[model samples]
Target: MFSVIMYHHINSDDLPLSNSDTMMDAHLAYISDHFTTLFPGDPITPGSICLTFDDAYYDFYHYVFPLLKKYNLKAILAVPSAYILEDTEIAPEQRLSLKHHEIYDGDNYKTYAPFCTYTELREMIQSTHVVIASHSMHHVNLSEDSVDLEQEIFGSKVVLEEKLGYRIESFVLPYGKYNNAAVALAREHYSYVFRIGNALNPSWEGIGGLIYRVKGDGLKTADELFNPFKQMGYWFKTMIKMLKGSR
Candidate 1:
């Protein structure tokens, strides 16, 4: 089965505002011992799990990347092509303090860019431990009719490929919001499309190229993930989402 765990910010100061480094390290350790960690394009088995970090936050470069190296594991780093800068002059702590949407605020881009820079991303990719996926161009909601499906779906693939020098085969719907038009257009451009749903998939094939990811950001510890109750909870949530038919 294919199961994906998604994360966002991993604060350096052990702050749980989103997720702390210590807990993430523990999670990496547990995953290394238990599941066979796979990159996006790799072949999978029953115990396979894909670890994905969304937004390519600075904390990821500072904290989680090292933990990934320590565990010798591979992961996907989802990047919003518009929010990313070539480089940032701000400190990691300062950038980590602001809300993700703050980057769009006037002159905030000059002060501090919240997302990772292309330089940083390139460095991570050099290690062969990371794969980049498009999280859309502006990270906007695709359900809105005013939004441009070409720019949000295919355009992001173009930008990331030009900047990062890699063929981006995956599209992670921003905010997990997408209409059928968005999905249909995405399938036309990319081989894999991802969204938020805590479930297990049989494999990457026969799923119409759509994959579901679980929330790994709110986890408190490795135990919380491995707990039997939590395991059942994931399945139950997945079933509920399946019933609702992906709004």
Candidate 2:
């Protein structure tokens, strides 16, 4: 089956600062040992998987890149371009507001460290093992009606495409939040849109519309790494939970 696994920060701290470096490596190792690592041009549903990182965390550039290089696997990075170079041009008041309120580099405090800088993102892009996509301009949640969803969707795509000089066709919903309007807006601008869930593979509906993604947090455990039965069991549990929640 085809799947897109979502990841965030990659770090060693277990104090729960949103770091996943420890788990990410374990997940990659599992994939390397059991499954054939596939890139963007891969065909799935007959058994193919795609690895994706979200939020453009600095830890990803620092910690995740080395592993990708070692495994020779390409992963998609969904980044917000607006906050990349916050030091320059971004107003001081705005910067302070972001630093104080926004979460950056897995830190919840009032620090001003962007997940990664433009240079770092560019460097990652230079590698054949990485593809950068748009998360959004402000990484704002599309579920909110406060901001025009279309503007958020279209503007972010334009900025990313212009800044990176690459066709930004894929988008990930911030906070895994969205609705029909958000979906329609996204469809207008992006070829694919990923939502957060814990399913094993892309549903037939997901493929026909945009795209769907499942979280890869279980990747931390190395005990039954790459075991099909274990993976299926995990997915089964997750689907059951989702179904229960819906009921």
Q: What is the C-alpha RMSD of each candidate to the true structure, in Å?
A: 2.7, 5.6
Clashes of each: 0, 3
**lDDT tens string, model 1, 180-214?**
89999988888878887777555664144568887
Model 1: residues with Cα > 4 Å off, grouped in runs: 12-17, 206-208, 236-247
Give Cα-based local distance difference scores for all models. 0.79, 0.65
| Root-mean-square deviation of candidate 1 | 2.7
Residue pairs in clash, model 2: 10-21, 11-21, 58-115
Score every model by TM-score: 0.89, 0.76
Worst 10 residues of 1 by lDDT: 11-20
